[model samples]
Target: MLSALKRVLIGRPLKSTELGEQKLNKTKALAILSSDALSSVAYGPEQILLVLMTVGMAAFWYSIPIGIGVLLLLTALILSYRQIIYAYPQGGGAYVVSKENLGKYPGLIAGASLLVDYILTVAVSVSAGTDAITSAFPSLHAYTVPIAVVFVILLTLLNLRGVTESASVLAYPVYLFVLALFVLIGKGLYDMATGAIPQELHTPVGTPVAGIGLFLLLKAFASGSSALTGVEAISNAIPNFRKPAPVNASRTLAAMGILLAVLFSGIVLMAYEYGIAPIAEATVVSQIAEDAFGRNFMYYAIQGTTALILILAANTGYSAFPMLAVNLAKDKFIPRMFTARGDRLGYSNGIIMLGICSILLIVLFGGHTEQLIPLYAVGVFIPFTLSQSGMMRKWLREKPAGWGIKLAINTVGAAISFVVTMMFFLTKFPQVWPVLVFLPVLIWVLLGINRHYGAVGEQLGLSTGEPVEVIEGNVLILPVAGITHVVEQSLSYARSLAASQIIAVYVPFEREEEAAFRDKWSKLHPDVRLVTLHSPYRSIIQPLMKFIDVVDRKAKENHYQVTVIIPQFIPKKGWHNFLHNQTSFYIRTRLLYQKDVIVTTVPYHLKK
Candidate 1:
């Protein structure tokens, strides 16, 4: 069923023999790696205000410090991750760092956190984009969830087509967003400083609390740190870059950091100058436009740009989810389904899964940016703390003369991030505790699944006790229905397995057909053994099983194993399945249960 669905969704697989291949050049590589970092410009500000709104207007002032802290964190994270790119350019990201330094459990923790973060990146970004669009056209407010779901579907389809194709389309909107944001910030700052700001521009959301304390301040900082969500994405994508990966990745990281700091700081300053309300439901970009341009064409342009950038931000998840899923699969922390590559050389199953999960989140939060904010930063910062700690271990291991400098930087980064993670967990536990509980249970389940697979492997004798070499033999047994082209192909396959004696077995359901098959086989291949088994109740599988048991007994005596080569007819159309019997499928499955019995399928193509 999964095979049929995969074919329908992603198209038929291309054989390696059928196509030429080329490697990704620097431009293509840069676009792929930069997707997540470029996406952050969308929701970073909204996340900051989301928490501040809880304590009213005075708490909004904390956004300045929060934004500054996030910028510094971003820089520290960028520098630390630069070391990761240099050390493990093959692109394991946080998972690799933790595994190499910490233990497998830490690696699993990192992997799970990364996976959740990627999915949220998709949900939050799309929901935020929908919010931006609704701000411009209030009618969209009613259809926000549906619209966001449609975007997820569209993005999934584009990714299934190919990474290069999706990246090409996304690169332009991201660049446009950066340019428009810089221009708007520059203009807003110039206007504010010259005393040319409008008199009626200010609109405060709530009154300040006179006795706000440290708890409120920490809460605000945690909210602002949400801006750092996409910082780790580049580290995860180092393997996707061109040759000399670390060099290219470092440059990309630098570019992302500079742009993010400028855009994020600019938005905060502009919001403050315009006296934009710290409403939980409001986006700073929209407020800045309303204050600076006053419902004019420029305001409309900014709204459109903001929406575009938010949608593009979701594209970050499109690139990260599949890669993270692949890493987890490698480490046996996720189901192998995530590791399966589609026809387009992308993780199609993982992409579809991410889209579905994102859609659920959008529905759960009712597409409200404010409601989803509390649940956002907890997963991201946990992984950030672990990654920095891993980097500290990495620097200690290398022990170069200049290592002390890097280690000091990473140590401070780790301590700050760790404290921030704890602060967010404490402040937001009422809302986010459910996720913390849910994630550990999910991780434990995954570990149990991997253990089960290991047990099965042991039972199957597929696991090596001491990794010794052993020789194995192959045998082929083709199940023939009648004397036709399919039967002929089966005979040919049996001949190919002549190294082990080839046998063609036929199950007789009716007397007349049984006689006919015997007569035809005698004429076709007189020397080859043609065994016939009678099905008293006209049951195909029962007769086949009895015959295989008898054959198994003979093979045991002779010390030779059996290989069942089933001749399957490939259906050209879906409805053809109803026209033919499913005997081959049942036969293959039954044969699999017999010890020392191997199965091979020789498929026959139906005529066009």
Candidate 2:
């Protein structure tokens, strides 16, 4: 039943050979990979306005300058990541680039930062999308947390279905969002051109919390840095593109950056010219739409598509997190299970883990977008700084064609990213100190994992000139609960091993039961010896383990191997097995820690 249900939800198991077909083309790739970066235009401008709003309505005049600064930063990241796409076509993104060019510790830091950022991507994107929903219908505000979590689950399931399939599924809404926003922006621009009067937004002017100073402007810029959150995703997932992966991925990255700039600039411009201030319930974009189109179909269309693309924007993290995990796992810095693909050729474990973490974050933050935004940019920018720094170091060392220009671009990108990261820490640290603390702790954990894997390899590694061991004979110890066909089958199998000796051991709870077992054993004229043990406390495993230890020591003296056979029976149905005691299982589990003792299970299948 479970298998049938899984088949229905995620579809049937795909063949390994179909992996090539799963790779995406440029258009679908743009939809799946670039959605997060593109969707930020919906909320990115508002984040800047939100920060500046603390200083009263007069501070709203600074939105354009901050927006331009964000665009310049965005341009730097685009150029740097395009270089990253070509330089490291194998595509580990920041983790690989930093590790290979810098050192292991730097690489681990980059990996840890990207991992945290991806989780926040889902949480922040979904929360922002839920805010969009509440913005449309204030009555649904109470259900925001539940709505966001449900969307995360649905996105996770869609991704589990397969990459190509999920991309195909998410592409339409992204394009729709872009088209809708363009119409709104164009209409707003036409009104401005035709000398239409500005609508009174009736924005509540809050008391000024901070003066208009350098710190205030930088704080607002740091807030707007959410626009650059998902930029690294394309660089990380270059391998997911079709043939000529690097070229296609670079083009997609460029296209994504261009769209982001235009949309972001247009929205901010519209907000300023229309005197649109963000209200508690409606978003800046929605407000702009209402002013330009006035409570009509266009207004709700922008809200519907905005809610959709923001939610679907979480798909960016869904695509990149699993890919990044696979890279980390390949390097032994994380568990190897992440490297395995699911039946649909997606990294199912990583995808599901991302979903679980995102849902937890949504619940913890109460689906508040602003509360989660502070934690978002630090993770992204730290990696951005590391990646560009790594690239700069690479160009200086390798000095490939056009190395000087590449170095300069990366140097600027790295400097800008570092400054923004510090700005994020300085401006948002009171609320975001946990992330600052988490980055170091996470890097330490990654180092510990790397050390452990190294130790394991050292211990398990075989020396070149080592001689192989040959075993001549073995001692078979069979543990039996009572005289039954299960015991008979165990003894027969043990005899076939041609051991030096076979001992059938039993732990009897009562003297009467031991006597009856001995009488039956004597009637059979058994070839193997029978050892009986007493358990005053009815602890079966304790006496059995003690006896096995003694027998194993004796076998060592005789140069014989020790093998313990556990006799068990399978119930006809899985649920029926609960009716029987699991003593055989306990004995087998206890024997697992014994270094020189071999354990085996002999099963008697029952037909019902």
Candidate 3:
């Protein structure tokens, strides 16, 4: 069932070589990595205003302090993670940082945190983008979930085409967004300085609170800190950059940090100057656009830019989630399938998996950013704290040249980040604690289960120290339906196996047909053996299954192995697979359970 759903949602997996020949240069890789961080410029202001809204417009000034705090944290995180790229250029990001210094449990914590953060990145970005677009066209409001799902599907397809393709497609729009936003914010500032500014735009209504409290402060900080969610993605993509990966990666991180800080600050200052209120439904970009341009062409342009950036922000996850999953799979924390690359040389399975989960989240949350925000920051902050702590630990353990200086800065950064993270849980846990509790427990349980299974298989001395064994046998038995390409391929395969004996078994439904089949076999291969089994019940699977059991019993007595080669046809497009492969599938399943038996499949292609 999961396979069917995967096929319906993600499409067929492609080989790594099929991803195309293009490699990402540092500029393009940076753009791709920065998409998530740059995207925060659109909604980061809105998130702050969201928290402050409860306190009324009089408290909106708090956004400035919150933004500054977040910016400081962002700068520290960028610097700290830049060291991460330098230390581990192979690109494990937070996972590598925690694992190498803080040990396996911390590594797992980081992995789980990053995983959840990536998932929320997709959900929040898509929902926020959808909200922006819907604001431009009110008719789209009711179809937000559908639109988000379609967007995710399109992004998944683009990612499957290759990372370079996705980056190329998104770069132009993201750049346009940066240009448009910069222009808009610049225009707003110029008008404010020149006294040409329009009257204050009425902000969204909110419940008035008496005063600022610790809870409100923590909530504001948590909302502001979400801007840092994708800062680590650049570190993860260090390996994907051109030669001199560390130098290129660090340079890219620097550029991203400068641009993001500027953009984030500009948006917040502009929103504050315009007297824009905290909007529960609209984004800061849209609110600013509406006020600055008053629903004119420039307004639409800013709206378009913000919407595009939000959608492209998910590209950050597209770029990072697969790499993290591949890393986890390498460590045996995730299934090996996630480690496999697709035709685009990207983590195709991981991409599709994330896309599906994100779409489900969009649907479940009704594409509302506010509803999903609670589950958002905890994952990101957990990793941020742990990763910084891990780097501090590494600095202490190694005591390398200049270690003292780096350690002092990292220690301070880690301490501050850890306190903020704890505060986030305390303030947001009423809403987010459930996810924090659920995701970690779930990940640990899965890890424990995998370890238990692996340990048991190791004790049993199984192949590759894993529970599953690759079946091997010699005797070839092909279940055929007269002569076809499927039969031809099965015969060719059996010949290749070079078994001591080959048997073609068929279950005859009628007496005359059975006699004619025997006569034809007698003429075709008189020297070779042909077994005819009668199914008076006219059942295909049962007779073949019984015949295979009998063959297995006989082969064991004679000290021979049984290799069942089923001649199965590929189902035509739009045809039910169960009707075509049920017999062979049952026969193979039943035979595999028996001792000294191997199952092989020789697939025959069907014409379109």
For this target, which candidate reaches the highest TM-score against the unseen true structure?
2
- Across 289-338, the per-residue lDDT of candidate 2 in tens digits comes to 88899988999999999999999999999999999999999999888899
Q: What TM-score goes with each of the models?
A: 0.79, 0.95, 0.82
Tens digits of per-residue lDDT, candidate 1, 1-608, equal 88898677655676544322312444554455554555555556656666666665555666677788878887888888888888888777888888788888888888888788888888888888888899888866789899998988888877786666677777777777777788788889889789888745443434455656777777667777777788888778665565676788778777777877888888877776676774534467887877777888888887887787787677777777787888878767677888886787777788889888988888888887766656767788888888889889888887977899889888978987898888877877787886768789878987997897777767778445655433244445667877777778877767765556667788887888889989988998897778888787888788777777788767767666777888888888878988988988888888778776778888888876
How does candidate 2 fare on TM-score? 0.95
CA shift of 482, model 3, Å: 8.2
What lDDT would each prediction earn against the true structure?
A: 0.75, 0.90, 0.80
For candidate 2, list the clashing residue pairs, or say none: none
Question: Which whole-number lDDT from 0 to 100 does residue 59 have in model 1?
Answer: 58
lDDT of 1 at 369: 70
lDDT of 2: 0.90
Name the lDDT value of residue 200 in candidate 1: 51
lDDT by residue (1-608, candidate 3, tens digit) is 77776556545665556434445777787778898889987776777887888877877777787888888888788889888899999998988899889998888888888887888899988888888899889877889889998988888888886777778888888888888988888888888889776545423334244788877876788778777778899888776777787999899899889989999998888887788876555667887878777889999988887888888889899889988888888887777899877655777799989999898888888888877766776777777888888989998889899998788767766876787778777777676777757776868875885697688767877455555534344567888879666787778778777788899987898899899999987887675578888888988888777787888887777667788887777766645675554776777787777666788878876875
Best by lDDT: 2
Greater lDDT among 2 and 3 belongs to 2
